[model samples]
Target: MMAAIATLLATTTALLFGAIGSRGGKEPTRNPEELVTVPAAPSKPIRTSTVRSQPSAPIPLANLPTSREPTSPQLALIPKPNAERESLLERRKQAGDTGILPGVGIPGGIPGAISEPSAANALVSSLGAGVRKAAAGQPDKAYALEQKDTLMAQGTSIRCALQTRIITDHPGFASCVVTEPVYSFTGKHLLLPKGTKVMGQYDAEPDSGRIGVIWERAITPNGVNIDMESPGVDNLGSAGHPGHYSAHWGSRISAALWISIFSDAFKYAGAKYGPTQTSTSSGIVTQDPFESNTAETIQNIAKQAVRRAANRPATVTINQGTIVSIFVAKDVDFSQTIKAH
Candidate 1:
């Protein structure tokens, strides 16, 4: 009983050891090999349709015209009639019955009016005769006589003929009296001293005797005395007699040369005096004889007067003196002493 029990115990122990060994072999001690991975080729890149924006159109200019430009219109050139034509027309109108009209058969008459020659023709003839007489006689006297006759026939006085004279004893200064013929009650006459630079005027009728106004006297720096006279007349018709007219007219005569000298002197005086003021009753300024402070007033006044005289275009005269009348104050009293020269 005891041996059988031992054998059974041994067999049990061996069966248990075999079962433990089978379990250890199935679990192994070392780790498994790592897996190697190969990367796939990159897929072809996807293509996108590119849409580029087109550039915008340019703008147009404002001033430029799309069509043809319009053209400009043309102007006309035409002339009008002059004053001579108008005068001829006026003469034609007055030819028939107007007694005041220029005499039809007179030397200056219209063409075909009478057997007598035209005034223009007669003037030419007289001029020719004067030339011949000057050639044949004492040239100076004959020429002077011819000029005197020409003045008388023209109903105009020579500058020398209108002299009312003033004499100056001064060494550097001189002057002469002047006179004008009165034509009508309302007519205004201009008078300039003998040897005064003056412009001339024309009259339909001849000038007459002079009437007295006032006298002026002045002394020069060199101790010379100057005397002057102003004259008036009732009517030029009263002076029709040649001797009577010439007697008074002779007093007003001045040398043309002297007159020119005096004009220059006057200009100098004006410049020295500065601009003179002329005012009316209302105190309104009328003439400014002076230019600006820098410019000369006297010269300006003289220039203005000359311009006015020349602008008349119909006549030739020294109009500068007229500016004095315009610029001088009407109400102001001038010293006779100052005016005399």
Candidate 2:
């Protein structure tokens, strides 16, 4: 009986513990709002771009940096109305002239000369006067042209005779004696005596057998020096002293004959000979290139020598006492010298 009572109490203790465990496991579910607390709407997003401006302070007028004065001169000028411009225009209209230039009138002075003295005109005048004064004349000495007073006018032909031999190969001085007296334009007064001495330089290069020299000066018999840059001419109105011409044809002819023979020989050797084969026909049938070229060169040289010999300049031999005329290229002033006679 005691064992059955103990069993009943054990069963009662088990049922009470089971009931407490089931009630603790069944927890009540809560709302999402209560579980995850909604974040406070973000305080209006903090602005990144807006700049907070500081108040501008007033600056004193005198303390402000000022611009420096201009280094270049003031070129832009204000235009002003000219009262005389209209009057000048009216005057020009009344005169029946329509010119853009303000002062356009016939000058009182010589034609092609300006009479008015404007700024530009005065400057030009001063510049011209300055150029004429010291530039033309040396500082230490002054030079001027005296009256020429030529006895004979231009284009006068004076008869003169050569006193010295002249060879055209070399340049040299020559002298002449006047054969006839020179007279004034009217032929009333004698200008130069018959014995007047004339001198010149024969410095011209040989142009074949021809020669013409300039007579540089003339000396009167009375010992007064005169300038006569005249030309020596023949009586036939041709220039230069008429004299003997020695051709020396014998030497030229000998040289030309020898040159011709040598040239012919060279030309014969250089002539293109087509292949001529012998009975022993080796395929190599050729002329020596060096020999052919040398022959051609020699032929050309000989031809040139022959040409030179034919065109040789003849020797001009102007002997003493040959007659020549002095062409007065310009006025020959012998008045100063003739007055002494």
Candidate 3:
């Protein structure tokens, strides 16, 4: 009985302690620093920056290597020869050296630099001047062609005017310059600038006054060589460069003079008539056929040679600044050679 009472009292004491421990599960107040957190010190705002870079220096032209000459295998520094020539041509054109500018007398022409001689402009003025209108007409936009690319198509015309030139019956070379800038197919870029140089050659003893020209090659303003085997044409698209044929008067006269001298000397070679008893029949005696025949044969040969000398072809005279068109026979690609502005 005493043992049971002691066990009950012990169980009661354990239950009382478990109830108090379950209700006080939080940590004791002495550790208050664990519940508090210190706010981080505020940081200053970040600053951004924009840095600009300097450009590289340009290269000097003197430091560059020499360019290969188009005509020869040698190297040279022929800078802007086309431009210089064009400027000189412009000066000449202004001074009326060619008697007309490239775009003269047309409706939408580059206006004549100077007043044309009334004689030169007579026909052009007469056409418009005779048509008089009283009321002012409304202005309209000018017509323009659309250029697309740098390819100069075949059959395209590159108009050029040659300087005063004369060609003899001997093989020689000649050249011409483009009169204006040739736009590309799309009209967006330049194909050949004004003053483009074109080189070609003529054969000895041209068969006719209408000399057939095979435009050999072309050089652009920037000195880029373009391959060309284009045939020449007139403004009306007819073939060849036409010139006036002048006979060699000096050679013909010389041949005639030789003929006169030889004729007198050869006619009396057989014999001479002299005073005789029977002057009628025996006065002029016939010489041996062999000697007479030999003289006659020699005289015929001399005449033949003179005739041949006089019949040789004379020189063809092409007036200075005669214009021609290069009928391009193939597509001219300048994309790799030139850079667009």
Candidate 4:
């Protein structure tokens, strides 16, 4: 009886609890007005461009930045109005002038309303003056020719004779007497009269047989002195140019002296080889002999001679009355004669 009462008590407690739980377990009704529906947050979508988007519209001229204004000088480089430009072109065409259209073709196409001095023109002007000065002669120097004229032309020859003997041993100021009259191409006037002196100097080369004779000055029949720098030296007929002659004759003497010494050595050796009469116990015996010492002596002598020659100064002398031909190095204005100073 106690067990059954316990079970019955448990069942009554469970049924009481089940009824309270069922009432509490019911879902509550939602009123449409009271239901709070939260909307989703806003989102930005990603777009991939297949082709380029349209370019932005050009900014209106009025909206352009106006803070920077082109100055008058800068504006002068801009082209003028099209109608005005056409009129100017027409005028230039009528005038047959093709001068540069100042500032017309620049980026701004603004006509150079105000002309500015051209740097290029200034440069050209400076260069032209330089050319004129150069053509006249070096700066500050009197012109060689006052006008278009020549003292002598190319290939015109003048014959002159040495006034004094020119020796290769003593070089100094030497001159030549003009023996023959030197006439111009036309022969209307005498270029150099007889008795006129053509003066020059010889420069001796040390240790060299060569001597340099530079024709530098001239004296006219009236004793008028002149400089030869205006007219330069040139090659004469057959005698060759002064530069070549100076080198050739200068070295020739030295070479000839050496050649003669060697020749003498060979000659001596030949004479030694030749049969010679000898007095001995055996009567008149011809003997072949070699003299090494003699050869060495000859070489030593030659060397000593060369050394002595080196100590001697080279000289060139032109004998008096020897005709010489030379071309006038420059155009000389005989009328503008310079008196002897």
* Top of the candidates by TM-score: 3
Per-prediction CA RMSD (Å): 32.6, 26.0, 39.1, 27.0
TM per candidate comes to 0.13, 0.42, 0.46, 0.33
Give a tens-digit lDDT track for model 2, residues 143-196: 542343445777888888889888876789899899999887767677777999
lDDT per prediction? 0.37, 0.69, 0.70, 0.58
State residue 260's C-alpha deviation in candidate 4, in Å. 18
Instruction: List where candidate 3 sits over 4 angstroms from the true fold.
Output: 1-148, 247-254, 265-301
Give one digit per residue, the lDDT tens place, for model 1 in 200-292. 222222233322222234223333343322222123422221222222222223333344455667766666686777767676668656434
Ranked by TM-score from best down, the candidates are 3, 2, 4, 1
Which scores greater on TM-score, model 3 or model 4? Answer: 3
**Poorest stretch of ten by lDDT in candidate 4:** 238-247
Candidate 4: count the clashes: 18
lDDT of the structure predicted as candidate 1: 0.37
Error of 4 at 143 (Å): 16
Model 3 TM-score, all chains together: 0.46
Better of 1 and 3 by lDDT: 3
**Candidate 2 overall Cα lDDT vs. reference?**
0.69
Better of 1 and 3 by TM-score: 3
